[model samples]
Target: MDATELQAISDTLMRIVTPDMTPKQLIKAARKEHPNASKRDIARAAFFSIIANADQDHGKAKNLQAFAIAERTQNGAE
Candidate 1:
């Protein structure tokens, strides 16, 4: 996807996710919100969102990064 599409997906994921959520929970929530999106796409958007927010929210970034890693691992894409 292009930068703008990626940003939009990231924004959507950020709105749906919380720091307390696990990787499965995050992916489930993302898939619920974006039923047509591929799992890899959602994971990529989530990763971008985590990095984008890292400067302002390190704790959240860490949690979300963990979720992304778990998602990647579960999908055998890591």
Candidate 2:
């Protein structure tokens, strides 16, 4: 997707996400909201949203890190 679409997806995910929710939960919710989006796209949006939140609040950094690790592991990335 393009930057605008990515940002829109990220914004939607940010609205639906909660601090207590896991990355898988977030992806499921995002998929429900955006049925046409690819799983990779949803994860990328979540990553960007979490990173942006981390930039504004350092407390979110751990969530971002955890999500990143989970995403990489799920994708079979090293």
- Highest lDDT: give the candidate number: 1
Candidate 2: segments with Cα more than 4 A from true spot: 57-61
TM-score of structure candidate 2: 0.71
Candidate lDDT (C-alpha), each: 0.78, 0.72
Q: Which ten residues in a row have the lowest lDDT in candidate 2?
A: 57-66
The residue ranges of model 1 lying beyond 4 angstroms of the native Cα positions read none
Distance from true position, residue 10, model 2, in Å?
0.7
lDDT by residue for model 1 (14-73), tens: 676676787667767877766777878878987998889888877767777887788789
Each candidate structure's TM-score, on Cα atoms with residue i matched to residue i, is: 0.75, 0.71
After TM-score superposition, the amount by which residue 58's alpha carbon in candidate 2 deviates from its true location, in angstroms, is 4.3
- The 10 consecutive residues of candidate 1 with the worst lDDT sum are 11-20
The per-residue C-alpha lDDT of model 1 at residue 41 equals 85
Distance from true position, residue 2, model 1, in Å? Answer: 3.1
